[model samples]
Target: MQPFHPIPVSVLTGFLGSGKTTLLNRILKDPELRDTAVIINEFGDVGIDHLLVEQSSDGVIELSDGCLCCTVRGELVDTLADLIDRLQTGRIKSLSRVVIETTGLADPAPVLHAIMAHPVLMQNFRLDGVITAVDAVNGESTLDHHEEAVKQVAVADRIVLTKTDLVDPASREFALFTARLMQLNPGAPQISSHDEDAIAAKLFDCGLYDPSTKTADVARWLRDEAYHHRHDHVHDVNRHDARIQAFTLTHDAPIDPQALEMFIDLLRSSQGEQLLRMKGIVAVADRPEQPLVIHGVQSVFHPQVRLPAWPDDDRRTRLVLITRDLDESYVSRLFHAFTGVPQVDTPDRQALEGNPLAIPGYKS
Candidate 1:
């Protein structure tokens, strides 16, 4: 069979403590997230969550050693550009889907701009969708105090209501307000983390790619099947915080094996603890003859499997991650490291495993 080349990337955004990480953790555990790639971007000078997520040696990104110094734009673009190069050049494993997590405090517009406008970055990557996180308990006050929080909610393709298990009855009004805010931007779907609210909604496949297109499909990364169910519940339900959020990211394409190995290695070293679960269907460049299916829990990755034939003729790749303490940027760096020049000198796999910057998980 011929090789497939094309990928779909997703952006996850939310306010501080909105359960963005938690929702991500839940996603990684899905049996269906095999052969996927995940990027988590947390705010502040240090990115500690990368150390906790479990990923394949070549499927994860962690540049800060322990934190993120990505406050500057150039650094951010350079990082994303590198990941793109790996994906486009066959240096890194061809990823079926790219999952990105943004810091709670991040102004998503700039990040979106990078995905849409940057020359090197734009050619290979696309804005799947903005997955925003809101705290069911404190989200109301957060919106009132943090303009960034409001903006996060304002532009979301899918909203994951985190900490639904802990929402107070008093926060009902604000929760409703958040729902109204989302109603204003109905293009995106909304789901919850921990609670089973989004099961019937279109929250499952929140990507930007059109299933009809081949290489140039633009789509949001995270797709939640519960999009419609959640909308119905919003009006009829009294409390919306009792459920947990989870979703999927799927695609068809061939990935580079070497780059994937490096990406997974980085995940073990930096973000195992924060990583909850991961799975994906990948298109390997070397094995363009066939596709690969990958799956894993924190540190424990399933061996890549060869499918009898492409799930579909399009042959896109799919990757889904459920996480905590991690975001899209944190994860993106792993993919970036494989494709670009390392900003800081990083230890090879041997040294990284022993270093404190690493998250200890299943090594092989």
Candidate 2:
């Protein structure tokens, strides 16, 4: 039997009028994305008239650049499963990658979960990353009024700022908007939609593996330094932005495997919805020589990956979390309790388990 190589699936999401289609159209033109299969909600929604070459009998639209576009006839999982079946049966010539373009107002978490949580899909597809489009002109107001928009940006692996040419980069409004994004998701790199250099290579492959080097690029994948230097800008207490928090949790000591599992379970069970996204590399006490990589979208987590050896000299545990309606202090205390770090007024692991009410910021 041949070894199974999972295809990488990238999600492109944004709020209404955010130019998600525009960015996706530009991305499909790239030669690197030639064999990519784009899954969209509707053909009309994407407006690929210029790129459309012909439509197959099975509802797959072949692009001029050798890309294939298919609409979701049923569930996303069904579409993905069909794609896999086609590939295996030789109905589809080849498939290098998959791009799922979500509806404008849709929460990207469900889309991510469809790929991550499904047992069969998990084996065939690996989450590449999330690319979110933000309209520069209305992004501020959109985020202010729409929690969905905020989440789209919060969980993004890469943010493409659209209509940037209309807004003056030197303006205070633009600066503040960008700063707000940084506060919401410090680790995600922001790119301008108009950036000619923002090609398929730059936008995709944000997982643990760096295709360019064919090695595990933990440092680039985690981007913990961005969180360390996160902007301390204050937001209005009543605004949606205030509810979203992005922060890093670090510990010098190696954590026990059991304790780590307990902590993750408690967090996921107690406040999974609030946990928009989390990715970390940990130093395990059992295997001090090897590091564990963990990535999760809300409650659904990809299988933990154990690296043979530390990627670099920095072996300390680093976890970056992007959460919504969740307190950072609460998470910090929970970690400290599990890691056996002493802190005043924080309940220990036993106490937390014994009395769930003891968890700070937790509502029964």
Candidate 3:
């Protein structure tokens, strides 16, 4: 049976001349990254970007002919569709993942908007993560002057500080300050691009927001083992927009499958947009032997898979949510209502069906 789950497609973004290509070159150079499909977009003509990216035939798509936002938006969709076609037809043996290297001057939002909103493409690809490369030497001023750079940092799942080795030893202090400048979204893991080993580790599977693995050094993800939510101007996003937010939900007992399904359907149908990311290991009613892995993107989901066995004895349902305009009040209330627990003080579903937050769309 074919799975409803689609492979993750991570976006590689950074402002113009911010080492997005250099890091991509490093990734291509890495032997471990062989199972990669790199899609490079060149807004202007001539395709010099394609010349820089050296990969095997059929694996690399040189999209230098048109602007991804306008002229080639259809081609962008068709290009990914074509990759899927080749993969299924055995033209390409196997595809582990896809990476889109946007033009340095491009805004990732429209590109991401294309990926999420397009009906045919959305089913075939899942947004894996956004990796933003920032030039440590010039990042501060660039971030100061460029709103795109700031938005890049604001939405990144991981921020890589590249080209830091050349700076003077005292420059390390500025680097650290720049690193602090990025706590705007404290949930993302920050790493140095100079270390290939560490970058490899952070790029793929890090709890990022909330690592499902208990083995995750929670201390690092929390920035402190005894982490308490601290408000920062980096995270403030004006007196109005709330970008950095965190909330945890705890369940004392196992959840019934029917109840859990209903709960998920409610979330997918209601608050999908605000669900920037969510993951949990839940205890099932009869199967205390194994826990269900609950993972989702916006509204779409991978059939919550069940592990053969719990990673450890620590089997409590703990979920973490990272969002832009959402909070615990909204999520917890809806979940509590679906489950029979009256944790929320609000009225029943019939009353709140008309609410805006109750029907967030999965599409961008």
Q: Each candidate: RMSD to true structure?
A: 20.3, 2.2, 7.0
Name the candidate that leads on TM-score.
2
For residues 30-98, what per-residue lDDT tens digits would candidate 3 score against the true structure?
555555666765434223454343333433543222112112345678778877776787666566667
Give the TM-score ranking, best first: 2, 3, 1
TM-score to true structure, per model: 0.48, 0.94, 0.66
Per-residue CA lDDT of model 1 for 4-54, tens digit only, reads: 443455667788788765666556445444444556543332234554433
Displacement of residue 190 (Cα, Å) in model 1 is 2.7
lDDT of 1: 0.52
lDDT value, candidate 3, whole model: 0.60
Model 1: lDDT of residue 265: 64
Q: Best-fitting candidate, measured by lDDT? A: 2
User: Which regions of candidate 2 are displaced past 4 Å?
Assistant: 210-214, 345-357
In candidate 2, residue 132 scores what lDDT?
94
What is the number of backbone collisions in each predicted candidate, taken in the order shown? 128, 0, 1
- Worst ten-residue run, lDDT, model 1? 236-245
